[model samples]
Target: HISALKKGRFWITPDPYHKDDNIQIGREVKISCQVEAIPSEELTFSWFKNGRPLRSSERMVITQTDPDVSPGTTNLDIIDLKFTDFGTYTCVASLKGGGISDISIDVNISSSTVPPNLTVPQEKSPLVTREGDTIELQCQVTGKPKPIILWSRADKEVAMPDGAMQTESYDGILRIVNVSREMTGTYRCQTSQYNGFNVKPRDALVQLIVQYPPAVEPTFLEIRQGQGRSITMSCRVLRAYPTRVLTYEWRLGGKLLRTGQFDVQDSTEYTVSSLSRDSYGVYNCNIINEAGAGRCSFLVT
Candidate 1:
C-alpha cells in the first residue's frame, strides 16, 4: 500500500531590495525582489507602483524560477532606466494552490536641476596674438540658472588686472600688448553651476591666433646672367608673412619696359635674366608689407 501526498498552500515572505541613500542623475541602478511559495502551481506574478498595477511591456519583465527544481522564487527586471521611473514598486505573486507572496521596493532617482552651458571667445584660434592688430571673438551660452564663466589661456587663468591705471573696458576681454608669435597656444573657458545637491561643470576650447605685419628685412640683391647674355636679377626676402607675389620692371632712363622684353619670377625674390639693352638702365625694387610699401633703387651700368 502507498500513502497519498499532502498538498497545501504555502506563503512566501516579502523580500525587498533598494538603495538607502539617494542616487545621482545619469547613473544606472538596479532594484530586486525575491519571494518563494511551496508547491508552486500555475504561479502568476504581478508588479505594481504605489498600489497601481504595472503594465507589462518591453521595459519591464517578470520571471519565475523552475517550479519542479527551484520552487517559489520570482524576479522582476527593469532595463534602460530613466528619471521618470522612480517610485515605489510592489511585487505580488499568486499560485493555484491558494498561496500568495508580497514584496515592496523603494526606489529613489536622483534629479539634476541645472543644465550645462559653456562658451569660449575665439574658440578656433591660438591665444597669443600680434600687437596693434584687432582681435574679435565671442562667448555666449544658455543654461538653467545660468553658470559662472572663467577664462584661461596657455594653462594660465585670465583675470582683470589690478591697478589704478587699468581701464574698466578691459574687463572680460583678453588683450595682449605687442603680441609676438611666442604667445600662440590653446585657450580654454569653463563654466560651472550648483543646484541643491547637484553640481555640473562644462568647458569650451578656442585657439588664439595673432596676426601682424612682417618684421625681417630683405636680404642681399644679386644679378645672375644666363647663357646668351640673358640677365636675371634676384632679391632674397627673409621672415615675411602674408606672402606677396613679386613683380619685376626693367627701366631704360626710368621708362618701364614691356612684359615681352623680360621675364620676372614670382614673389620672395624678383628676377629678370632675359636681358637686352631694353633690360638695362637704372633698376629699382619695390617691397610691400601689410602696413605699407618700401622702394629701393639700384643702378645697372
Candidate 2:
C-alpha cells in the first residue's frame, strides 16, 4: 500500500529593481515578483494594474525570465512614467500541477508630481529627404500629468496626415507622406500646459529639407527683337536640389542651339548675336538635373 503525497508550500514576495532609484516622470520603473514553488517549471505568471489585466505595450512591458536563468522571477516595466501609472500592481503565480494554491502579490508604484520636459533625438532632427518620400517627426515628452503634444509649422499652419488642415496635432508624431518642397521648413513641437513646478521647457524645433526637381518660371516668354540685333533668352530655375551637375540646353526650330553644364546658377541664358529671321522664331531652354528636367519657351519676334 502507498500513502498520498502532501501538498507543497508556496509563497510570493514583492521585489524592487533598485532601492536607490526614486519614482520620477520620464523615468523607467520596474517592479518584480519572486515565487517559491515545488516545481518551478509548472509556474505561470499573470499581471494586473488597478484591478484590470495588464499586457505588454509600448509603455508597459511584462517579462518573465526562463526558469533556468532566473527561476520563478517576473518583471513589470513601466516606461515614460505618468501620473496615472501610480497605482497597485498585482502579480499572480499559479502552478500547472494543481497540487498547491496560487500566490498573489501586490506592489504599489508612486511618483512625485513633476513638470513636462520635451526633447527630440539629435540624430532624428534636421531631416533631409527628396520628394515623394514619407517621413516622421517624433517628439518625446515626460511629465507627471501626461502633457499633450502638438506639432505645427513655425511659419504657417500644419497639414496633418489625415488631410485635415490644422494649426496643431495631438498625435505626438508628425507624419508627412509624399513629401514636397512646400512642406520644407522649421517645425515646432509644443506642449499644452506646464507641470506647475515651473518646468517650462515645453518646445522643440525640427528642421525639414525637402528637395525636388528643377521648376522653371514663366514657361512661355514673348519678346520682340529686330533683325541684326542681339538677344538674350533666359529661364529661372526654382529652388531645386543638387545644384551641381546640372545640364542646360538651348534649342531653336527643332534643333539644338547650345548645350553646357553648370555647377551653381539660378538661371540659364542663351545669347544670340546678329540675330537673323531664323533666330526670331521660338527658342526653348531646357534644364536637366538628377531629380528631373524643366523646360521653358521664348518666342523671339
Candidate 3:
C-alpha cells in the first residue's frame, strides 16, 4: 500500500479465516478484504494474484457481499491450492475521481501435493523423413506451474548435408530443414527447472530416421598417358541407412565386363589393367542400395 492511497484511504487487509491461516495443498482457502474509505458507494474493487487479474471460476470466487457497508468488502475463495496458486494476492479499490488504494497478501501452499505431473502426448509419433525433406517433431507437455521443455539430440550422427539446420521452439517443437541421411538419431524432450520444488523431472524420446537414394555421380580414376599401367574407376554412395551393403557392377557399353579384363575392388570400385581396344568404349557403374539404384558413366580412351 502506498501513502498516496490515503486520499481515498480504503485499507485492504486479510480478514480472519474460517479455519486456520495455514492453507494446505489440495485444500480450499478463503480470504475476505475489509475496505475502509471515505465513500463506500464510489469504491470499486478488483482482485489480482501474482500481478495477473483473478477471475471467478469453479476453483475461485470473488465478489462483493454488502454494498451498504461503511468500508467496501470483497471475498476471495480458492477451491484448491495448486502449485501455481502459491503467490501474492492483491486487492485494489478505486473511486470515481481517480483515487486508488491497494494491498497485497501472500498465500503459501504445502509442498506435499504432487510433483508436477508432466507428460508428452505425441511422444509415440514416428519422426521419419526422406532425404532433402523438411521435418518436424512435436511434443506437448501438460503439467501444473507449466513445466519448462528443452530438446536435445544424441551425437550419433550430424547432417550438415548441404547446410541443413535445426531449431527447437519454446513449446517443445523440433524442426529440421533439408533433412539428410546423416541426421538419423534419437531426440529427447524433458523439463528443466521449477523454482525450488522437488519435481520428478519427466522426459520423452523420439527416433529420427532419414532415408536417401544412392549417389548418381561417381568419381573416376583419370587414365594417364597410354601404358601397361592399371586404371582404376569407382562407383560409390556416400550415405545409406544400412551403408555397408551396397552392390556395384561395372559394364562396358551395354554388356557386362569380363572378370579377366577388370578387377573388382570391394563393392564399389573396379580396375581395368592391360588396356585392350575393348576398353576404349563407355564404362558405366551401377550402384544399388536399399533405397534405390543409381548409375554413372565415363568414356575411356
Task: Flag regions of model 2 displaced more than 4 Å.
Answer: 1-117, 130-134, 141-147, 154-171, 177-182, 191-202, 221-232, 238-247, 252-257, 261-266, 271-283, 288-291, 298-301
Kindly list the per-residue Cα lDDT of model 3 for residues 1-301, writing each as its tens digit.
Answer: 2222322221222213334323466666555554455555666677788778988888888878666563366667777767787766666766655545454433333343222334445544556677788887767755333434556664544433333333334566677788866668787766544221223456777778786666655545434435455677766555455455566677988888633211233335567777776667678887765667667677777
Show where candidate 3 strays beyond 4 Å.
Answer: 1-128, 143-148, 154-171, 192-200, 212-218, 224-239, 253-265, 269-279, 291-297
Per-model clash counts, in order, read 15, 0, 0
Local accuracy by lDDT, each model: 0.44, 0.71, 0.58
Residue by residue across 222-276, what tens digits does model 2's lDDT show? Answer: 9898899998878888766767767888999789988988765688788898888
- Report RMSD (Å) for each prediction in the order shown: 21.2, 15.1, 13.3
| Per-model TM-score on C-alpha atoms | 0.35, 0.45, 0.46
Best by TM-score: 3
- TM-score of candidate 3 to 2 decimals: 0.46
Which should have the higher TM-score, number 1 or number 2?
Answer: 2
